[model samples]
Target: MYDVGTRKQALALVSQGLSLNSVSRQTGVSRAAIRSWRTRLEPLSPRSEPCPRCSETPRDPDDPPAYAYLLGLYLGDGCISPAPRGVYFLRVACSDAWPGLIDACAEAMRSARPDNKVFRVPRQGCQNVTCHSKHWPCLFPQHGPGKKHEREIALEPWQQRIVEAHPWDFVKGLIHSDGCRITNWTTRIIGGERKRYEYPRYFFTNKSDDIRALFTDTLDRLGVEWTHCTRAGKPYNISVARRASVALMDAHVGPKY
Candidate 1:
């Protein structure tokens, strides 16, 4: 028999959109066993009503701007854990250097569920915006084990609707968390004279190919062009260096803060 922890891990993997075969291979469990666990642990049907006090009058899942932005942030650097009783806790980790982002995350949580208390927990080099809400798992069913690259990160149909409505906000949240805007410079000799020109660009780095695909898809929808490259011994990157593409991103995502 699988331990409770293993069962939970397997359920989480299934929640993250992993196929039965993939979960079985990763967990060294038989596909039949994983399938049975999924049937037993996951809800057989979607709940008709939101959890009481957890997300009473839950925010509209289709609202694109703020909620989608927050969802992006959550998917990038957030986690959900079991709290006291049966409640779930949601926490989004932000670097100390970006106070705006920290505040934004806190505000977003409050906006999503006004009754829930949102606060920050300070660590060595980062601060986490945390709150106790029973609806966290409902809000972010994407919660799972390990890094995003290790699992499939696909959005549900409802989430896809929100993202389709506010692709820019989604991009904004994504870039603010896992991407950066910077300046690039190159020097060349023209007419026996050295000249240097600088240009602005955006770089988004992530280990998850699915997440990267989502980012690129949004860029594509916005008519922005980008290129893929990799840093030595680092994650893959999608770079937007062309003037037009940078301008487009600037209009949508802008600077981190």
Candidate 2:
């Protein structure tokens, strides 16, 4: 075998496209030695450093890297006001993508304007448990005693209102309920009923922010401008009757009410 110098030259020649055996012969080095030298010269990239903030990279299927970044806002002052108030949308349990979901909701809340704090609700369920924020648990508590397989259940007062108030204005537009007769809401739009032109309806939780998107869309469809109101006071009947009575007097008399 040739000395180290010849082996190095042989490897250089092979790298330049000279045949391995040809390189060995020209440089007086063995083909095997040239092969070994060539392998050693291959470039290597720098090793990556671990992320500094988190000890472990989150591995839950629902927690995408993007969501982790978004959720970071909640841990900071950007979204966490001293005593924030709003109708925040929250997922109920630790199901699929709980972390990512929380991240997204937290991001939306942080971005909301100061005066409009009531428009969103901070979601809750598992306190520190890693969970998907998207599929939030029911906003209202269970009606009856807690059990694995409960037989019957009832709606909360607000939940009942959402069901009973055939049609409601979210302040943005009409918010309604929908479910098969077998489900609830005490009505059906089946065969014979289909003939009637029914008003549009939708389901929303006590949390108004959760249904903000629905409110925005409904207003667009009805060609009406609306503002989001988080509180629910007395029913719309009182307001509707007063407006109607004022209109009746104005038409009969002057423009005065």
Top candidate by lDDT = 1
Name the TM-score of candidate 2: 0.18
Candidate 2: tens digits of C-alpha lDDT, residues 42-141: 4222322222222265222122332222222222111211111111232212212244534444343233211221122222432221211111122223
* Cα lDDT of model 1 by residue, 217-243, tens digit: 988998989998878955489999989
Cα RMSD of predicted structure 2: 22.7
Estimate TM-scores for all models: 0.74, 0.18
Best by TM-score: 1
Instruction: Report the CA-based lDDT of candidate 2 relative to the real structure.
Output: 0.31
